[model samples]
Target: MLTGLNVAVIGGDARQLEVIRKLTELDAKLFLIGFDQLDHGFTGASKVKLDEVQFKEIDAIILPIPGTNHEGIIDTVFSNEEVKLTEDLVKSTPPHCVIYSGITNAYLDKIVQSTDRKLIQLFERDDVAIYNSIPTVEGTIMMVIQHTDITIHGSKIAVLGLGRVGMSVARTFSALGANVKVGARDTAHIARITEMGLTPFYLDAIQKEVEDIDVCINTIPHLIVTAQVISKMPAHTLIVDLASKPGGTDFRYAEKRGIKALLAPGLPGIVAPKTAGQIIANVLSQLLHDLVKERKGSSQ
Candidate 1:
């Protein structure tokens, strides 16, 4: 039990509710920041403003999945106030206090490093990424259905990248009878795609492959779908980019060419908050428990 542990849950979306519930159940004293507009309350949690939180007493600080942006601005869905995480705020925490986030940016990295604090990025774990692909694939299928008039049964689909989300997308679309082709940079990934009975092509040859595609899904975080690549595709092609913010697609070029392009990141959280939150909460609970045990052992 986290009876004496103090945790501060900062700005997030619907998924943060599940995290709060799980943490409260463990008996941790929670100071919920950026939840002023929330109507409900937890047994061991209290909604508080950022200034009210005593940073030195915090054992852990939980940040939203996207964490802070380049300007240190956090996404606060339940509050009207703008929450910014600065270096001074982190430095005020106890030396052993750990910071948890889904991902980190240059701004967050710099501050955390300056403070010499432990920062755990949960989404970097293989299990989290693989499990998250389930919801992402489901969301992708939903979007495909909503946007395209043609059926997925026989449509030509191109999935760029063979990572966790890309693999799932290819498999699911192929299973639905779509003519799925996956593009990859690594030879091993190309071989794996071929082994899965789906067509595989080198990413460099993407222009040739997308010429007749009905739908193009990009999982690469870089500028893989450039103007040249989009020009090669049919006008009816739908481009779905699942990469992080400022996705891989050339939106301006796509728009100029009259092509429909969508940037969808954090699909799991958007499509299935409860499941996504549980995934995070489960992992977080175990990690915190392990931390507590380690600290106890060292003290003994």
Candidate 2:
């Protein structure tokens, strides 16, 4: 049980509700920041403003999946007030206080480093990424259906980056009778794509491969789908860039070329917040439980 643990959940959407539910059930003391407009209440959670939280007593801090923006501002959908995470606030926390986030930015990373506190980016874990890919694949399917008039069956699809999400996307689309082609730099990934009974090509050959595909899906977080790459694609092809913000595809170029390009990041959260939240909550509960045990052992 996390009975004695004091956790501060700061600024998130519906997913954080699942985290709050699990944490409260474990009997943790929760100070909810930036949830002023939330109608639902939890037993052990106190909805308070940022100033009201006793930072020194905090055993853990939970930031939203997106963490802070470049300017250190967190996205608080439930509150009208601005909840900024400053270095001073992190420094005020107990030495052992852990900060949990789905991802981190340069701003948040610098704060945790200077404060000498632990910062865990939950999405970095393989288990989390793989599990989250399920919803991601489903969301991808949803997007394709919503945007394109053509059926997935027998449509030529190109998936860039053979990462967990890319792999799932390729497999699912192929299973649905789409002529799926996956691009990757690694030889092993190429062989794996072939093993999955799909066409495999190097990322460098993306321009050549895009010539005939009906849909182009990019999972690479970087700018792999540049103007040159998109220029080679058929005008009728639908481009789905699933990377983080400022995704792989060139939005301006795609628009100029008269191709429909959609940038979709955090599809799991949008498509299945409850499942995504439970994935985070389960991992966090285990990690927090481990933290408590470790502290107890050291004290004894």
Candidate 3:
């Protein structure tokens, strides 16, 4: 139980609600920042302004999945307040306070480093990424169905990158009877793709692989699907770029070519908020509990 722990949940969407609920149930004192417009309330959570939170008493700070933008501005879906997490705020927190976020940016990394506080990026964990891929794959399948006139059965599909999300997407599409081909830079990943009974191709040969693809799903964060690559694809092809914001696809080129392209980063949150929230809440609660135990042991 997080009996005496004080936590500040700052800036998030519906998924944060589950985190708040789980923490509150564990008896953590929660200071919910940037939730002014929310009507429902958790049992042990209180809405507070950023300036009003007593940072010295905070044991942990939770940030949204996107964490902060390049400017340290947090995304607050339930509030109109423009919340920004600055170095001063981190410095004000107790020396033992740990900051939790789904991901980080240069701005967040700099401030955390300057403050000398531990920044735990939940999305970096294998369990989180693997579990998240489930919803992501489901959402991708939904998008492909909605946008395409052809059925997934026997459709030529190309999945770029064999990371957690990429592997899941490729496997699911292949299971659906799509002629799935996965592109990877790593030889081990290519071998694994072949082991899975799906066609494997080196990323260098992406142009040739995409030439007749019905759907191209890119999980690589970098720009792999350039104008030149898009030029080789059939005009009826659909491209789903699941990387972070400003995904890998050349959106302008895809548009010019009259090809449909989608940038879907946080599909888990969008397609299954409750499940995604539970995943986060479960992991976060255990981590916070462990932190509490560690502090107690160190003090003794």
Over 4 Å off in model 2, which ranges?
none
lDDT per model vs. reference: 0.94, 0.95, 0.96
Cα lDDT of model 2 by residue, 1-300, tens digit: 998999999999999999999999999999999999999899999999999988999999999999999889999999999999999999999899999999998999999999999999998999999999999999999999998999999899999999989999999999999999999999999999999999999988888989999999999999999999989988999999999888989999999999999999999899999999999999999999999998899899
Per-residue lDDT of candidate 1, residues 177-265 (tens digit) = 99999999999999999999999999989999999999999999999999999999999999999999899999999999999999999
TM-score for candidate 1: 0.98
Candidate 3 versus truth, CA RMSD in Å, comes to 0.8
Model 3: lDDT equals 0.96
* Tens digits of per-residue lDDT for model 3, 1-300: 999999999999999999999999999999999999999988889999999999989999999999999999999999999999989999999999999999998999999899999999999999999999999999999999999999999999999999999999999999999999999999999899999999999999999889889999999998999999999999999999999988999999999999999999999999999999999999999999999998999899
Instruction: Arrange candidates by lDDT, descending.
Output: 3, 2, 1
The better candidate by TM-score, 1 or 2, is 2
List ranges where model 3 is wrong by over 4 Å. Answer: none
Clashes of 1: 0
Ranking by TM-score: 2, 3, 1
Residue 232 error for model 2, in Å?
0.8
Which of the two candidates, 2 or 3, achieves a greater lDDT against the reference? 3
